[model samples]
Target chain A: TQLLEQSPQFLSIQEGENLTVYCNSSSVFSSLQWYRQEPGEGPVLLVTVVTGGEVKKLKRLTFQFGDARKDSSLHITAAQPGDTGLYLCGGGGSNYKLTFGKGTLLTVNP
Target chain B: EPEVTQTPSHQVTQMGQEVILRCVPISNHLYFYWYRQILGQKVEFLVSFYNNEISEKSEIFDDQFSVERPDGSNFTLKIRSTKLEDSAMYFCASSPIPGYTFGSGTRLTVV
Candidate 1:
């Protein structure tokens, strides 16, 4: 079984702060995706990183895939209240099934 | 943007009762999936359906659980006998490409 382990399960920061969430796994993945979920809602796709050492940016959020494709990271720059939510990283392998990390709960207070 | 939608945002039932959860995925999507997340737990894949048949399933999807795409538009998950442990948030998702588009989800509470 493949598993993605996320670190810093809970983060509380003030507005304008920068934070990074990490997802690591022992198995390599073909692609990795980041998602943000608000209360009472399903996770919404934020970005997907397919190539090794790839980096993608969406507004204030930045996602990076490790060179080995076994890990990924999400960095939020100048986070605001709107950025507060549960962040999840999903790893896709050859089986076509997405294995998700436990997730990081981030709270950016104004 | 196209999205997946689910009905009966919440349902409460007694143990041993049967329940059916419905979902309508993006019209043009070819793959559909069902997932569940227990309170304070990570989301887990229950089953994946493609071409009107189950392509993959997890151990959690036992004899009590089944999935079907009755028509072109609707996908359903039926629980033959609900157990107290079945209480969780059930999410329906669809994929046109790789990443999935997930529905808001249905909260199932089995008493």
Candidate 2:
């Protein structure tokens, strides 16, 4: 089983639409990170949330860490075709490894 | 901006042959890692290295897998004997903290 669970395993939306993807875990973590990946490339770090109940915004992308540090959400405002990619959530797990989610495949139609 | 660099963006090898994947992490970073993603699967950790030694490894990192920081700036992962199932995209990463920078990845195809 995946330690981190992401919902809407696949999301397809039109341009100008908004969407929210979620990550949930039963275990707490010291930090949670979100990454966006395109085909044939490595994942690029989008944001990291260290403190509980903290909210961070990267332009149109908004990220939030739950008060317990066990969940996280990514909200995209006015999605664009460039926003299409794989969104993955990961937490600092044991052995210095990041426990990754199954990921949500988001495809924004232009 | 600094980035982790990986060579041979793609590799095709016969089963039972050995392959060594190379990486040059960002200068001044002390921690290094190897992660791989099988097609349609989430990225999985293979091993982490620090201070010239392995600090952690996953169950998937078995006898056939080994990691070494052969030089001050270069790190490598070797698969002793490749299997058909070993085909995947391997990524190299470096980190100063929880945040990490990853390489574009090397797609390994075992035939």
Candidate 3:
């Protein structure tokens, strides 16, 4: 089974602080997707990285895919209270299914 | 932007009862999927549908679970006999290829 392990399951920080969450897997995937979910809502897609060693930035959030396609990371700069949510990483393989990480619950205090 | 829409945001049912969750995917998208997230757990893929048939299903999707695209736009998941373990947030998603757009989700609580 393909498994994605996420580190630091929980994180709390003051507003404006920066934090990074990591996702690691032993299996290689065709693509890696990052999603953020709020309470009582489904996950909203944040970004998808397909190329090895590729990095994509969305305003304050940055996402990177490992060169081996076995790992990924999400970095948030100057986090705001509105940025607090559960972040999930999903690995897509040739089978067209996504294997997801347990997720990192981030809290940004105002 | 087009969005995936799901009906009955919250559903409560007794164990062993039947429940059908409904979704309307984007008009132009060809891929539809169902995923669930237990309380404080990771999102798990349940099934994928394409061309009016199931493309893939996880082990978690058993005989009691079935999916259908009754109409060109409506995709539905039916649980013939729900167990307490079935309680979770069920999300429906549609994709053109590269990315997926997910619905707000339906919270199913099997009591």
TM-score of every prediction relative to native: 0.98, 0.97, 0.98
Candidate 1: which stretches are off by over 4 Å? none
Candidate 2 chain A weakest ten by summed lDDT: A90-99
lDDT of 3 by residue, B1-111 (tens): 788999889999999999999999999998899999999889999999888899999999999999999868899999999999999999999987756789999999999
| Tens digits of lDDT, candidate 1, B1-111 | 897999889999999999999999999988899999999999998988888899899999999999888878999999999999999999999997778999999999999
lDDT tens per residue, model 2, A1-110: 33899998999999999999999999898899999999999999999999999999999999999999999999999999999999999898654469899899999998
Regions of model 3 farther than 4 Å from truth: none
Evaluated at residue B111, the lDDT of candidate 1 is: 97
lDDT of 2 at B60: 94
In candidate 1 the C-alpha lDDT for residue B30 amounts to 85
- Model 1 chain A: which ten-residue window has the lowest total lDDT? A92-101
The weakest ten consecutive residues by lDDT in model 2 chain B span B68-77
Query: A89 in model 2: Cα distance from truth in Å?
Result: 0.6
The alpha-carbon lDDT assigned to residue B11 of candidate 2 equals 94
| lDDT measured at residue B41 in model 1 versus the true structure, 0 to 100 | 93
Residue A90 deviation, candidate 2, in Å? 0.8
